[model samples]
Target chain A: MLPTPKKVTVVAGSGEGDHKLTAFDNALLAAGIGNLNLIKVSSILPPECELVERLDIPPGSLTPTAYGSLVSDVKGDRIAAAVAVGFSDRDYGTIMEYSGHCSREEAERAVRAMVEEAFRRRGMALRDVRVAATEMVVGDRPGAVVAAAVLWY
Target chain B: MLPTPKKVTVVAGSGEGDHKLTAFDNALLAAGIGNLNLIKVSSILPPECELVERLDIPPGSLTPTAYGSLVSDVKGDRIAAAVAVGFSDRDYGTIMEYSGHCSREEAERAVRAMVEEAFRRRGMALRDVRVAATEMVVGDRPGAVVAAAVLWY
Candidate 1:
């Protein structure tokens, strides 16, 4: 039996040009969470609800206050929230990437922060997260939505 | 609101694609198939399962065969074997054509035919399906694990 288990959540992000969506899915699954097991996480996000802003945004133009406001707009409708995710892959880091519009330095920092938070919340450690994947894709022509997902064990 | 209620189902020739997966999810919601849902369908064809030489291939290679196989697999796993599949569109057609492989006509015919046998035992009519969108994608790769979800109201 394996010592570690991976978890993943599938977020349908915009992929107008680049294979960003699939890439993201791949990243999460590679991180060991591509199981996509519905029984593990069915409808994590509510159906037909406006998404709120990130509770924490990477160092970027996305203002925390603005992000908080966006959250308020979506907080009312957020229905499908899940505490954990499922995976098909034995590892889940294949699909992770840096956050969007942020420098690599900032992206790495963001990941570190997230890892810490995940550990604090779940009592897990960075070493335990064997596979890891992250991304930060920006829209070339505009009118794109910035969304992301996290997978860990 | 519109007068006619909608019935939709998105069929993924391969289960793990981004657009097709997204469209399939949207179709299920459009069909108003209660809250029934599924995630990452496990391929019934085992790792050692070999492709047999068949003089008679279904209209769509990804036809109800794999999907039907998937249904039976799900049923075998304790879900209901009695399922209904309603076809709305073939979003992957363009990709198939662009790959310089299957012509648009051949691609469309394939998905349409597949939708038929998928629901054969359900006592349902393929024509009764409400197709919302069907587009062909060109210049693509091959070998996709197909998947479909049926919602019964």
Candidate 2:
């Protein structure tokens, strides 16, 4: 079996760039997680994983992450992204991601609700929840917003 | 630095389900990879990684993968997905994914071309190339096609 991640961190950021992918890259950079290669995973936090304040991964390393992002090229368009992590007692946690043409608060609320729903569906009692969110308004160039739960060994 | 993957496998499958996500899940199961947690990564095969005929990962393990998938709800519609890996003599390889409303042959051609383009852009001498693809026709339920390069320790 592959080793489970021991540390996790939540981060959010927004940015504008020349193109949509670049905008996304810039948003990830703003979120302080642009250097590593991100492997996107579905919502699941292993049991006994610890929440950390920051990640110290090297460039080009393969890093597992759960993220939500939105990009828009239309000027003045608002975009938001958020991620929520729900913890349970002595069991695995759940992660939820959301992105939409809405406010940061709305995105956060939606992701939290999704986490709660996931916990309910699993019959797990939700002990705590943590959220991170970001919003961006497009300017002359493409804009993007990203929120992520980064998991590492 | 995080440990790099040492083994890789190419797999493809198609399936039908009541919904899109389940359709995708069924496709993964058909491909023999549904039980694990997939971490989707961008196009890169680590240097010196060996190609394996199959993966032997445990259930619920976090498996890194590069993949392409297509889902269709319209009855009689055709969906195809393909993934290609281009290898260099002693350097990291490139992986390309493509999905479209086309035949499996067309999808395979497209993905292989993308891998060639990637090699050309990187100024790398391509030593070999491998591809996997799948196609599906939608019926009463939603249908999905998936092609993936599974990476493991």
Measured by lDDT, the strongest candidate is 2
- Candidate topping DockQ: 2
Tens-digit lDDT string for candidate 2 (B1-153):
557898889999998765554566578878887656687889699999999988897554688889999888999999999999898998999999999999999999999899999999999999999999999889998888999999898
The 10-residue segment of model 2 chain A with minimum total lDDT is A113-122
Please give the CA lDDT of all the candidate structures: 0.25, 0.86
Q: Which regions of candidate 2 are displaced past 4 Å?
A: A1-3, A16-44, A53-63, A86-96, A103-130, A139-142, B1-4, B13-54, B58-62, B71-76, B83-97, B103-133, B137-144
**Across residues B1-153, which tens digit of lDDT does each residue of candidate 1 receive?**
001111123333322123544433343333332134332221111111222222232221222121221111121121111112233132111000011133334434443443353334224343333212222231122122222332111
Q: After superposition, how far is residue A47 of candidate 2 from its true place, in Å?
A: 4.0
- In model 2, the clashing pairs are none
Number of the top candidate by TM-score? 2
Clashes of 2: 0
For every model in order, what is the iRMS?
19.6, 4.2
